[model samples]
Target: MDIDGADKQEEKPVKKAKVAAAQASASAESAAPYPDMALAQDIHRLTMIHAGKLSVDDATSITGTKPEDLLERVMLRVGAGSSKPFDDVIKENEEKYKAIEKEEGKDVSKVEAKEKEEQVDDSEEPLLNPELYRHLQSTLAYNSSSALSEDQLKTLAAHNESILAILAEGVTKAKEEAGDMEVLHATMEIARYQAKTGTKESALAAYENVLALPKLSVGKKLDGHLEMARVCSFWGDWRQMKDVLEKAQKIIASGGDWDRRNRLKAYQSLSNILVREFEPASKLLLGGIATFSCTELCEYPEYIMYAIITNLLFLKRTELKKNIIDGSEVLQVAKEIPVVLKLANTLYECDYKAYLHTIVDLQPHLVANRYLQPHSGYILRELHVLAFQQFLDSYQSVTLDSMAASFGVGTEFLDMQLSRFIAAGRLTAKIDKYGGVVETNRPDWKNARYQEMIQKGDLLLNRIQKLGRVVDL
Candidate 1:
């Protein structure tokens, strides 16, 4: 059985996407870059840079106002890996900033315009959410600029400062008055602003307060949790992200709107995958495939990749064929990355050897993903286990060499791998070393209790029925 598994990560295929992602929001005039999206883009490029698909120089060009910061982080040190020392770049940027400050000193025209902008009308329109601030900021910035520069940074810094003041004033004013609309919008502004522009700790803290507000609406409360969940995910705060997501799930349980429910699925699926919880992740990704509108965390095409990865890991052939092979949403992005469909078909077609190599090809992409990097080994290992088990289910007994041939691995290597997994209870087949054969002892007892892991023309179920008859006598 040879499975030609598809490589999930290909920076070249997504190169234009990455450049667009980085460039689309690459302006000093734009509202401050949403911190999570910015971090994700950098991580995407960093993995590409490390994997040789993207050069370090290209990465620098593709990243933020501080190319040195990303390069330094990429090399694990800005100065050590490249010819240029990081400290020098840091010094240069500082000096450049000081010179800009001196130039801005006499620039009263910009300041005067900014001052008027900050003097907000203090209207707490019931529907005027603080999240709209990010939407307005992102919209304004996207329309105005491309490529961040020192001047852009200065402008953005001042922009954040001005906006933060307005949001802070709104929050304080709402606190003094304590009306439902005023409190919800005011708190959301602080939470949403911090999520987009401030640190994770501050964002999480602000969100905590939002969720604590008695006057917060159900929809607004769920929004707060989801935003915090995204912030936690971007910062690699999985533990907190899990709690926040679970809380979101609870809120949605009491009847969230369609959009909110789907966004929760997208957010939870991403979090579950990062934390190595594949089962629930698979369900969420597969269920929310059609209604995936949560691009704030990731693009739809990228979301499809996650659905493919998780479902391929756990879905049985019948389930795989129905949900993925026949899935319209998964097929829609088929041309964008054929490998995702290729990988799924390889597994479904029972091409074990091809699937193994496909995983090998995908290793770089999996390892490069910021969210998937930590569990790269675990996911691959589980895929292999699924493949090996799928292979064994077709056999009552097979020689070690034959099984090895089925998977394109050496007999010795297969034996070693099988032994470890069998011992770990990952595989149900047992290796008979002296006989040079592996025998599967498929237990209907457990399968009936959980996964009915049977394939077409397999005797596992008949054997279970016979055993049940014997017990009845």
Candidate 2:
């Protein structure tokens, strides 16, 4: 019995040892950290460390991983030892700055402004650290689809020409490794650079590339269409310009936050399109005026002047005064931009010379604008024709030389312009070159009125016949 009990005790020890080994194995399996999870956590930690949101050691503690591999991966260099508090460092530097300012006897704001100007200059071609650049490059290669952040895109958009070249090169290299979406994004940036520095054709081609991309967002597509229209307008391709504007309007009508901005652009473009043809422009101008809010018009006062002048030229001043000019909002704005007021006074007074001079004085400013450049010649011609027609209303006949002198143009040029109007049936006159005189061809209003009445009577008779048929049924 004693021997058996001793044997059982020995077996008991062996069983306990086995159980202990199993628990230790379980514990190790539970504590074993995954390499991938560690790498991800370390990446975020490294970012925080670089952004100054976390001290290196603090990030290390939160991550519970040795950061040697992470530091190498990010290619970041940390100053040895604990970092001084950021605010304290800034405060110390500011004190030194103030001391230097005191010695120079300069205003603090002026000094700060000067420093900011210098910073702005430096920002034009900011130098990226080699280590950091390499790190970002590798990151973009690996995560091509998510290569750039919003902040990064803004920075790239704002960078100066020299820096844009560098960024463009980097993005091009990244394209090989990037996915479709990333490639699209990079393509957009490349195109913007091309547009800013290259020819309109290249920029247009770039924008077209973006449009061709699959599954693009509506806002992006809308932006692309608008840009294409602008390029077309820039080169005076009216047909192409109208097509793209139609495309953009469809997108805007579909509805989004981009509605207001897109509508504004549409109106601005439409204004440019009708610049030479004011009569048709007057129709569209009303819609544009109704579409824009008071705040928006404030940003684009030029468009406001356009709307006002269009109505005035159409003899719809009473209506415009009722809806716009007399409105509290527009009246306040008009007080600031008096161009429309001056133009109205000149037109109302029937002072053709003053009107011509007013347009001439404002022509340099208006014609210099990107949208208005193409229409400057047209505006002048239209005004000249209107002035001539008005001046001729009271005259039975006028010598070409006398008319040209009054209008500040050559007699031959005036006669040629009149010939075009006469040929087009726009002017009721004939040139008698032998006498150097223009004779008015008065129309018989009584006969024309009788023809108009007969046509209206025919239309009324048809409508009455249709009503009789309905009553009989």
Candidate 3:
């Protein structure tokens, strides 16, 4: 009896260890990327089992399945194999639904009579809940497809709208049935589609709705705030962007994980950019660039060039050198994103023409990046001023035509640009439009020196008079 008890005690520890391991594994998997193949397979298998879409034996035999394999099996079972598309599936379901409608129309009274007769059959249950079945099938169809084309996008958008309508028909019931996370995820997905398809207003509304949901998780709220910030960025709404970012940062500070670090850093970088806080932006970008994983770096490579550009703009070369350029990672990243090196070199050499050409070449890419897009106009203006200042340093007086030719622009354009600078009190020079020359009118150092001495004498005289009065002299 003692031997058996000892064996049971040992088994208890083993069981506890297994339970702990399983829990740890589950937590790790939950934090993994959505597209992780292994995690997808696990979710697929569990979903199939829970929905009774697979038999017990089949479920037992479904170990070590790949995502593609699961997708193929589900497609084949639904009469949608490699040759079939999502549109065909939708059309097929629509046809079946139409046929059911016709049958119900002809047999309405008969169905009512049959239902009355079978009222005593209390144990009877629906073979399939139509709503759940439809939801499942639509999800499967969506997951089984490859990248969506424009036509697919239109179809999907309509489908999502209908789903939203259905959910809206009973908001309380939908929340109870789908849970807050699922609803929030659906809303975010729809908002993203709207944003991508040029329905910015609708997207913004949907994102705001996500924030309004009660009992929403911090993670989902943060995501909604971040997405709204992106929308604000698209419109160059810096104040709204700042507000959304502040909310997102608060959520993260409350206990968001490292998995969200890259996104947080990216948003902070952008917020700094919009406010023209280049020094903090540069530091944030460099810190993220240094600490982010290879996968993260690949996912958010825009940080590299933005960092280099910000440092160059602020002339924080010493800090940039100490924190970034002097490091080996900058060189490695430069190899991955060559624009970093190009911008750095252009800034160092003060090559206005080359810099302008580089900026023009990279305009499309800059406009696409969420962090950089909102600030592109400001960045371009700063570049133009820097380029003009560099060109001005080379000559005391240059003809507008010569300057235009050097900058590869027309005289009128150059005149307009220089005029803007002059008006802004930035250039410290004037344009001699009649003479067709731009002349440097920097303050004369000797006269400025004499004026500084006179001011100092006046200040000293005032101080002496005050002191003499205090001393009763």
Q: Tell me each candidate's TM-score.
A: 0.65, 0.46, 0.47
Which rank order by lDDT, best down to worst? 1, 3, 2
Alpha carbon lDDT of residue 49, candidate 2?
Answer: 48
Q: For model 2, what is the alpha-carbon lDDT of residue 233?
A: 46
Clashing pairs in 3: none
Model 1 scores worst on lDDT over the 10 consecutive residues at 1-10
Instruction: List candidate 2 segments past 4 Å from native.
Output: 1-187, 231-240, 250-277, 290-299, 308-317, 320-340, 351-353, 387-450, 456-473
lDDT of 1 at 423: 99
What's the TM for model 2?
0.46
For model 2, give the 10-residue run with minimal summed lDDT: 3-12
Best by TM-score: 1
Off by over 4 Å in 3: 1-83, 88-224, 227-241, 252-262, 271-283, 292-298, 319-330, 335-340, 363-378, 391-420, 430-473
Model-by-model lDDT, in order?
0.62, 0.49, 0.54
Q: What is candidate 3's lDDT per residue for 106-136, written digit by digit as tens?
A: 3344533443354332112111112222333
The RMSD of every model to the true structure, in order and in angstroms, is 12.8, 28.2, 19.8
Best by lDDT: 1
lDDT of 3 at 331: 64
Clashing pairs in 2: none
